[model samples]
Target chain A: SQTIHQWPATLVQPVGSPLSLECTVEGTSNPNLYWYRQAAGRGLQLLFYSVGIGQISSEVPQNLSASRPQDRQFILSSKKLLLSDSGFYLCASTGGHTEAFFGQGTRLTVV
Target chain B: GESVGLHLPTLSVQEGDNSIINCAYSNSASDYFIWYKQESGKGPQFIIDIRSNMDKRQGQRVTVLLNKTVKHLSLQIAATQPGDSAVYFCAADNQAGTALIFGKGTTLSVSS
Candidate 1:
């Protein structure tokens, strides 16, 4: 029974403000973590993924960055938020051979 | 460039009818495929998965079919209910087991 927890379920941040979204996994260790953004009616856009601590692979060049501070903790951050940065942020983890499990997701609105 | 795409952006089905959603991928190297369901304001939930070695896999009320030759995948929902109304996405694993490449998604609207 693995569970993923993501916080600030919803956030309204001003433009150019800093952003920090955290995701953590329980019941598993050394899992693969991923960060994705989904826009209205669009597909998920992979932002970052980490296979281990201190290792992050960014898929797109954008205003966001990711960090794996612990084996099961992943953080998505941004120094400044843009209007285009508003979307549903999802945190997912996989055991490498099974289906990935997703968190409740964070709905971020940059106004 | 490797990408996953859906054949349709939206679909409306009558309740109790069967629904079929289709997807296509560009990467033949992908060995795993998955289907996800996302309701409004919720994260995508895993529905079913199929490996490239198998052509089809079944879940409680859903079925996933993979056609490796054509690089296509499909999700079938039997006796669709209103609860089944959601955006469905198909994803493929890039073989490294590092990440999943997701498709644009198809919104299924089940009307009573």
Candidate 2:
């Protein structure tokens, strides 16, 4: 059983402001971590995924990036936010034996 | 999978009715599939999963059916309740099995 925790349930940032969202997992080791974004009425978009520490794969070219600093820690960061970056950001993890589990998500509103 | 620019499909049902949500995935090489339920302002919740080997898998009140032949997946919720009102979506592994690919969600609205 993997429990994912994401912080600051909601965020409102200026277009040029820097952004960082954190996701931490418990009860699993060497798990696959992921970052996804969903627009108000659209589907989930895969941002980045990491197989292990310091390994990240970007699905699409965007203003955001992801990193796995520790076995259970995954971070999504943006040097400068864009208005189009406003969406619901999600963190997910899948281990060798478990299905994908998602965190509560962070709603980002770029002003 | 590319994100749909359009809105998700909607399913409106009365309470106690059997609800079925449909999804069509791309990649035939995707051997694993999962279903998720998401409430407003919250993250997607794991509902059930079905592998390519088995065409069907059942949970407490939900069932996931896989059709690799046509590259389709479906979720069925028995006795749908108002609390079950949420966005239900499906995810599948890519050809490489490295990351999960998501499909546009279906908004399920159950009325009492």
Candidate 3:
């Protein structure tokens, strides 16, 4: 079975501070990874996706960026956080054919 | 631009009653669709999925109906329980299958 781990489960960051959220998948290789953000009472918005290491696609222009350092490791980062950057961030992976699996999301609050 | 949207933002049902949620998509090229359930403070969970080729699919207690002609989809939950209360979302895959575009969620509240 494959599992995705994301941390920290909850984060509180002051405005203009740097942000880093990590997601790692175990038991799968070369999986497609994605980052999505959900504002309160809103649907998820795809932020970024990666097909392979060092390959990332941005779905929307924003303050965040994503990186795939290894086959199973993906990171979401920001040089400076904005109040609008606060939301529940989710990490998901798919085998390219089946349904995607999601990790426990990270709740980020930028105050 | 193509997008997925739900017909309603909230739904209320009594226990043991059947629940139906509807969605619509604008992308004609979408070949795959999925339904997800998210409890409060938790990630969305895969509930069921249906391909564009099939009109309907069934899971343990849920059913997904796809109407490609109208570009519509629906999720049916039988014998609704309180545990079924959550926000449900519908998603469609692009022709390339590279990314899934999600619809605004419909919050379902099942009372016992």
Candidate 4:
């Protein structure tokens, strides 16, 4: 199936609020998953990626952290959101050296 | 630092014409490259890809050309249509070779 499920297609939270965005993949084992943030009218910024459970890499140091608790589940979290955290957040998974599959994405707004 | 950038932010073409979108990568070591098309409020979808070992690759109506020497890449669309209007981005494996990186993207407007 190779499907990715990302919830809360749109979110509005206040600054300093906790944030959690979840993504789960189906039909693949040990797939590489990624979290990307895209600002309005800008390119995608790779925030975090996980090759396997408990093996996460941070591409950019920010207010966000990612955890891969299960082989097919990846989570993006923020203890305290910042206004700058607002952006279009996407979850993706791929087989190495192949095209990555993406979820619908969550549009977050920090007010 | 590794970076992928586009030469133009916007490109316009008339229906039935051909369109070319260009990208440049900073890391010469990057071998895997791909092109993606993103519509408004939608996730980017894979269009085509080429490896550094090859100079060109083609899909249904799209072609990807890679120039390892110049560190350049381009996507050519044959017979552009208004339905093809979207933002096109180029991606390459980063220096770490663990994740793919993306460029700012070029908006291709195909007028009918």
Candidate 5:
């Protein structure tokens, strides 16, 4: 079975602080990875996706960035946090078109 | 200009009743559609999915219906329970190999 894991399930950061969120997948390799954010009562907003190591496609222009250091390890980072950056961040992996497995999201609160 | 949207923002149903949620997409190239359920403080969980070639697909107590002509999709939940209360989202896969485009969610509230 495939499983995804994300760290720092919840975080509160001050304005202008650096951010780092890590996602790792177990039981699968060479899978596509994605980073998404969901605002309250809104749809999910795709932030970044990685097909292979060192390759990342950002879906939106913002203070956030993503990197795939390994085949199953993805990282979402930011140099400075903005108040608008606060939301629930999710990490997902897809094996095929059936469905995507998601990790328990991280609730980020920027003050 | 491709976007996905839900017909209703929220739906309330009594426990043990069946629930239907609707969604619409504008992209004609979409080949796959999926429904997800996200509970409070949790990530979205896969409920069911239907391919373009097929109009209906079923899972454990959940079903997905796709209407390619109208570019619409729906999720049906039978015998809804309190645990089934969550935000439901539908995503359309353009087969672009990028990612699924998600629609604004519809909150399902199940009351006993």
Candidate 6:
């Protein structure tokens, strides 16, 4: 079975502070990884996605960036956080056309 | 750029009733679609998926219907419960191994 893990399930960051969220997948290799942000009462916005290590595609431009250091390890980072950055961030992995499994998610509160 | 969007922003239904949510996609090349449920303070969970080759697929109390002709999709939940109250999103994939384009979510509120 495949399992996805995310850390700092909940985060509170002051404005202009740095941000880092981690996501790791087990039981799969070379899977597609994605970062999505969903605001209250809004649809998810794809921030970035990686098909392989050291390769990433940005969907929406923002202060956030993504990196896939390993085959199954993905990280979302920001040099400075903004109040608008507050939202629910999700990490997803897909082995194929099969359903994409999501992590528990990181609730970022930028105050 | 092409995108996926929902027909409604919110839906309210009575417990034990069936619920249906609709989505529209602009990408004609999309060959795969998925439905997801996101509860409060949680990540989106996979509910069901349908391929472009098929028009419908069922899982437990949920059914996903795909209309490639209209580029529309729908999800039907049978005997809805309060626990089914969540934000539902539809995602589309045009190319294999590509990032899915997600639709704006519809908040389903089921009242007992």
The candidate maximizing DockQ is: 1
List the candidate 1 regions with Cα displacement exceeding 4 Å: none
Off-target runs (Cα >4 Å) in candidate 2 are B1-8
lDDT: worst 10-residue window of model 5 chain B:
B92-101
RMSD of every candidate to native, in Å, equals 0.9, 2.0, 0.8, 0.9, 1.1, 1.3
State which candidate, 4 or 6, has the greater TM-score: 4
TM-score winner, 5 or 6: 5
Over 4 Å off, model 3: none
TM-score of chain B of each: 0.97, 0.92, 0.97, 0.98, 0.96, 0.96
Q: Give candidate 5 misplaced runs (Cα > 4 Å).
A: none
> What lDDT does the true structure give each of the candidates?
0.93, 0.88, 0.94, 0.93, 0.91, 0.91
For candidate 2, write residues B21-78 as lDDT tens digits.
9888778888788888889988998899888899999999999988889888888899
Candidate 6 global lDDT: 0.91
Work out the TM-score per prediction: 0.98, 0.95, 0.98, 0.98, 0.97, 0.95
Give the clashing residue pairs of candidate 1, or none. none
Q: For model 3, how does the per-residue alpha-carbon lDDT over A1-111 read when each residue is reduced to its tens digit?
A: 679999999999999999999999998899999999999999989899999999999989999999999999999999999999999999999887568889999999999
Q: Is the docking of candidate 5 incorrect, acceptable, medium or high quality?
A: medium
lDDT of 4 by residue, B40-104 (tens): 88888989888888999999999999999999999999999999999999999988777899999
Per-residue error for A43 in candidate 6, Å, reads 1.1
Residues forming the 10-long window of minimal summed lDDT in candidate 4 chain B: B93-102
Q: List the DockQ of the predictions in order.
A: 0.82, 0.71, 0.79, 0.79, 0.74, 0.76
DockQ-superior candidate, 2 or 4: 4
Give per-residue CA lDDT, model 1, range B32-55, as digits (tens): 899999988888899999988899
- DockQ of candidate 2, scored on C-alphas against the true complex (2 decimals): 0.71
